[model samples]
Target: LIKITYPGLLLEEILSTIAGNCLLCVTKLDFSAPKSLE
Candidate 1:
């Protein structure tokens, strides 16, 4: 059970990190699109 638990925790951490990065990318894109028109 200990072996299984460690991998699960690591997977969750990696997924959360990726989700955070994706959110930042989206926010930056939204902020930039309007400026390009000018």
Candidate 2:
């Protein structure tokens, strides 16, 4: 049904956004860390 599909699609979108933000944060941290320490 349209109603069920709508919520599922919204959930997927939210999850994708969260995942993208997490990845970006990790990438920034990776670049900021010292090579000798890592």
Candidate 3:
């Protein structure tokens, strides 16, 4: 296994940032999808 350190973006910060970005993308997609497709 390999280990590394992030002085700026810690593990929790990275995870939450990714989750937040995904949530935003999902919400936008939800808003963009056509009603006929639902």
Candidate 4:
């Protein structure tokens, strides 16, 4: 069971990191290019 749980924890950690990066990118883009297409 340890082996099975280890991968699950690792996957969760990776997913959270990716989500955080995506949020940061979106926020940065919005701030940098607000109303540019207008």
Which prediction has the highest lDDT against the true structure?
A: 1
- List the candidates' TM-scores in order: 0.74, 0.73, 0.64, 0.71
lDDT of 1 by residue, 1-38 (tens): 75476998878888999999999999999989988876
Runs of candidate 2 with Cα error greater than 4 angstroms are 1-5, 35-38
Clash count per candidate: 0, 0, 0, 0
Write down the lDDT that model 4 would get: 0.87
Is 1 or 4 the stronger prediction by TM-score?
1
Candidate 1 has what TM-score? Answer: 0.74
TM-score between candidate 2 and the true structure:
0.73
TM-score-based ranking, best first?
1, 2, 4, 3
Worst 10 residues of 1 by lDDT: 1-10
The RMSD (Cα, Å) of candidate 4 is: 3.6
Q: Residue 28 of model 1: what lDDT?
A: 93
Best by TM-score: 1
After superposition on all C-alphas, the RMSD of every candidate to the true structure, in Å, is 3.0, 4.0, 4.9, 3.6
Better of 1 and 3 by lDDT: 1
Clashes by residue pair, model 4? none
